[model samples]
Target chain A: MPYSVVGIGTSWGGLAAMRKLLSDLPADFSLPVVVVQHRGKDSDQLLTELLQDATDLTVCEVEDKDPLMPGRVHVAPANYHILIEAGHLSLTIEEPVRFSRPSIDVMLSSAADTYGKGAIGVVLTGANEDGARGLADIVKLGGRALVQDPRTAEIPIMPDAAVKAVPSAEVLPLEALAPRLVALSHEREKAGARRAV
Target chain B: MAVPVAAVPSTGAEPDRQSFKPDLERIEIELLLEGIFRHYGFDFRAYAYASIRRRLWKRIEEEGLSSVSALQERVLHDPEMMEKLLLDLSINVTSMFRDPGFYQTFREHVVPLLRTYPFIRLWHAGCSTGEEVYSMAILLREEGLYDRSRIYATDINEVVLQRAKAGIFPLERMQEYTDNYMRAGGKRSFSEYYTAKYGGALFDQSLTKNVVFSQHNLVTDRSFSEFNVILCRNVLIYFDKTLQSKVHGLFYDSLAMFGVLGLGSKETLRFMAHEECYQQIAPPEKIFRKVR
Candidate 1:
């Protein structure tokens, strides 16, 4: 199946990491990328704007029931837990999990549940263990689990936890992620075409 | 609404001690919600399951329970635990002048409609600690409509209602709210609305002179009165499709002809049964006017 969705979770040094990741993706990258970056409850739209400036793709903050469209980057708003349902996103005000709203685990697990084998979950540099279990869920559901190589990460706790949770996950240097995602998307597209024929 | 459960196998080498079953958990959650509703009369049975599950787990961890079934036991036997779970289940994420565009558009478009009314009744459903309610009061005051407007702010939880009635917010948020106020087309300094003291910015009490704060559950309560405008932003995102439709019906019944309905920027009246009954007043902001 074509990789239907990409869910990214990052924190600590996420602003720079996300800037680089989003900057690397081409303008026509054919997958919806949903990001959950941990930040203060009071954090403003400056982060979304900053990331948008670095990327060629359209980046928007996720709203309740916002449709998931390919070639767009959706970032979870600072204070809401973003749930991935079929073809759309939902926001909740449930109390923070592990002291964080827009929790990585919540987003990744929901994506895994919604997209199953068609989801791609990436856990990048962060200071917490939030995404580990969620990434494991993605892998369990037969989806790709990508982790930023801990050695190269600014804050390796998150990626390391992800790798530890799902040892089979591909751990790559930050520079390799965009290309790998592109290649995977192409592979999925070709497979989809073959299925169609 | 039933969320699709992915059958994810354990890929690890270790033998599974207890097989994880998503269906079992769903059953437990359903039972828990049913029990709570029957015993305590808080209807969360129709809430979106994923978020509800997360909140229940939070309560489970806090209460030292092992699973959802255990948490249900505690909830059924203990009122305090139910209160904690009630607070958890009710989503309260809010900010002053959230989605400044909504307020800005309301000021530009809906204010004119209200200007035509000699007396206005506005209902703010699920007002949640009153951030948006206060924001509306401020906006109406600036538009010279506060005196003629009676705002009814209601939430399911009484705890949040008390906090909303206080009208005191964190002083730290004042700077951020001021930015939003200015962005939403404030005519005067945002700081003029509240005085900072005791580590809080206590808003001018006179702004709420025509405002009423009460406990009203949208899932169960009947429409108390007709309204010229109803603002229920960011609240319906927690409900399933069934409840959303039902609430839309309630809003439709409550609104007078040409009255406005403002939802969070993320919400829409599309896919709703009442979609054709209202016309989109502001496209970017989810403000609609009932035309039929």
Candidate 2:
């Protein structure tokens, strides 16, 4: 099946990385995108606004039960774990995983389980090893896993971990990621269009 | 502009592979939650597994235990350990007027209906630490409804309930709370509501004169009375789908006709059995009114 959603995880240097990647998403990006960027407990709506300024896509801070819709970018709120259900998003105050509430692993694994082969997990720039296991889960579930080429990353630790964890993951540079995802999303939309016919 | 950094070759230390056995960890977690429920009656078995496992491991690591079973053994026998674990499980993050927009909507839309009632009973369920309950109290007072309203703020943990009753918050947070209050449409200077004392800001006692702080576990306890409004924000997210539906049913049963039901900013009634029974009073605020 064509992927229905994209799950991205990053920390540390994620803000700039996200800005570059999200800015590249076309306004009609077909798949819903969910992001878990580790942030401080008191971080305000500044991140969402910043990402919004970068992308044509509607950037929103994920609220509980927010619908998974195409063309919208949902960013997990700080200090809460965002779980992806079948067609909606849920937030949890349950303890942070690996000292990170918006743990990349939690979001990736949940998205992997929820979307299975129709999920794409992307591991971007970060300092910690949070998204590696989640990317592994995505790969194990027959989903695509992508990692930013560690050498190209502002913070390489995160993508490096992901690369080691999921050998099959496409390790591409940051600039190459947006085009790759855009192509994947376009393929899925074509598949969806074909199904409709 | 976002800085474009060149990609470096993968040269970091090898990833920290998961050391524990997944099947074993699952068994141990199930056993621990079951043990905790059987021995202490604090049921966490219905909580979502992934998060619960993370929390259990956190407690285990904190206690320097090697496994969930080991943590379970100590918690079952040690009251202090049990208390600590209880804090881990029940302690939720909340703030006064946390989502000012919700409070703003409440003041504008829900207040008029509350004004119509001769006497009002508001239930603040899972009111962890009571910042939100106090916010509601202040709002009621501003609307001139405090004189005839009684706010029952309950939580699963007594530790937070006591803290809520004291009405003392850290001095540093006052600035944030003041901003939230103003955004929520406060009628007067936010500083007028509290005085700094003992390095904390002590809210006016009169604000809570009609407020009752108590311990009530939503998981196992029955609703005590029908309420005009039941505000249980940010608490249900910790529960599994089964428990969330169960609690929603309880709220539905406990609400009087046309009563208000306010949830956390991120929560919704879309998936609940009683979803159609209520009307969304405030869009995107999670405020619903029982219409059936």
lDDT of each: 0.85, 0.84
The numbered model that scores best in DockQ is: 1
Which tens-of-lDDT digit does each residue in B136-192 have in candidate 1? 999999999999999999999999999899989999988889998988898999989
Model 2, B1-292: lDDT tens per residue?
1111111111111111232245566678889888989998898988765556667777889878898889978988998898888988885677788878889999999999999999999999999888898899999999999999999999989888888889898899999999999999999999999999978999999988999888888989998999999999888887877799999999999999999999977677867899899999868678999999
In model 2, the clashing pairs are A64-B266, A151-B7, A151-B8, A151-B9, A152-B6, A152-B7, A152-B8
Highest lDDT: give the candidate number.
Answer: 1
- lDDT, candidate 2, at A156: 95
Expressed as tens digits, the lDDT of each residue in A1-197 for candidate 2 is: 46767899989899999999999878877677899999987577899999999999889998776667776789999878888765667788766778998888989887766666777899999999999999998888777899999998999999999999999999999999989998987776666567666
Worst 10 residues of 2 chain A by lDDT: A188-197
State residue A19's C-alpha deviation in candidate 1, in Å: 8.7
Instruction: Please give the C-alpha DockQ score of model 2.
Output: 0.14
Q: In candidate 2, residue A168 scores what lDDT?
A: 93
